[model samples]
Target: MNFLDHPFNARAGDIIEVSLDKQANVRLLDEHNFSRFQRGASYRGHAEHARQSPVRLRVPGT
Candidate 1:
């Protein structure tokens, strides 16, 4: 399945998760109808704090 096909539904303090099998490919979108995760921003997951950033990745092998 293509990850890009699914729209991002992030927010100011939302902890979003993406699946991966050893490795994964990623892209940084400007601004779509959904929200985004900005680097340096803080988020609370269950009871822990975390940050967010736009990561560009290349999965080894096709």
Candidate 2:
């Protein structure tokens, strides 16, 4: 997914949460980091099940 297409336009000093496979990954993208991400830089990190509530899984088609 393109960063520009992200619902929240996270600016410098802003943090955004990315959900993957029912796991939540939080990212803090500074100006440089944000630029790199926008330019397709690969981000390597670990995600954990931090949410207390269950996340509803949705398929593309029912």
Candidate 3:
């Protein structure tokens, strides 16, 4: 799934986990992963969960 500059399909209560350490990433439904985990200011994730999970994601402003 492309959670960057685009939205993906996920049902309600679908889990969206964001992890950043060695890399920035988004795991949908706790199984599917975003195709790209762009570093710097090129990443994004949902600000909140929803049936329409277009959650906001981004690299911390520097």
Candidate 4:
């Protein structure tokens, strides 16, 4: 639903600065730590769950 061919109100190839939960399905724009996001990606600085996941699942999908 979010994968945009053409994002509304958002221009294509625009560098949209954003922060997200650790479970968000996204790839980092950097090169060092390369990992694929299945459910979603998270903001490393903001995602406490990424450091230590909850006993139960906190990720929305899985």
Candidate 5:
């Protein structure tokens, strides 16, 4: 499923899981604090479960 087209319904502080094919690299970002913006962790080849923050997910280089 393409999450960009059909995103899951979630609210703040909810825990969400993301799964990726072994070759995918995803960069997760916390956009909640733009003034003190800090990048979240990067993951590849596995699934990750984390609390939902104001975030954006992308491949490393557009």
Candidate 6:
């Protein structure tokens, strides 16, 4: 029931940003905030029904 666990709240085509750190896990990234996921932690059940999220762009003119 947490923020990241609620896939219904996360819309497709939404902006998702991942850390540049080499050890970062895409699924571990927080969808409702700017933070990294903890090790061995799992997302809520909603993740299974979640839509395909795309990464947001920070490039110039974007």
Candidate topping lDDT: 2
Q: In order, what lDDT does every prediction score?
A: 0.36, 0.42, 0.39, 0.30, 0.36, 0.33
Question: Top TM-score: which candidate number?
Answer: 2
Q: 3 or 5, which is superior by TM-score? A: 5
lDDT of 1 by residue, 1-62 (tens): 33444555454544445454444444433243113333434432222122333332222221
Judged by TM-score relative to the true structure, which candidate is superior, 3 or 4?
A: 3
TM-score of each: 0.31, 0.32, 0.24, 0.21, 0.29, 0.24
Best-to-worst order by TM-score is 2, 1, 5, 3, 6, 4
Candidate 6 TM-score, true structure as reference: 0.24
**Candidate 1's C-alpha lDDT?**
0.36
- Candidate 4 per-residue lDDT, tens place, 1-62, comes to 45312122333343444344444443222222222222355333112223322222222221
Q: How many residue pairs clash per model? A: 0, 0, 7, 7, 0, 0
Measured by TM-score, how close is model 5 to the native structure?
0.29
At residue 25, candidate 5 shows an lDDT of 28
Local accuracy of candidate 5 as per-residue lDDT tens digits, 27-54:
3333332213233334232123434433
What TM-score does structure 3 among the candidates reach?
0.24
Over the full model, what C-alpha lDDT does candidate 6 score relative to the true structure? Answer: 0.33
lDDT of 3 by residue, 22-55 (tens): 3334433212223334332333434343333244
How would you order the candidates by lDDT, starting with the best? 2, 3, 1, 5, 6, 4
Error of 3 at 6 (Å): 5.0
lDDT score, candidate 3: 0.39
lDDT of 6 by residue, 15-40 (tens): 44533423322342344333323333
Whose lDDT is higher: candidate 1's or candidate 2's? 2
RMSD of each: 13.6, 11.5, 12.1, 12.9, 11.9, 11.4
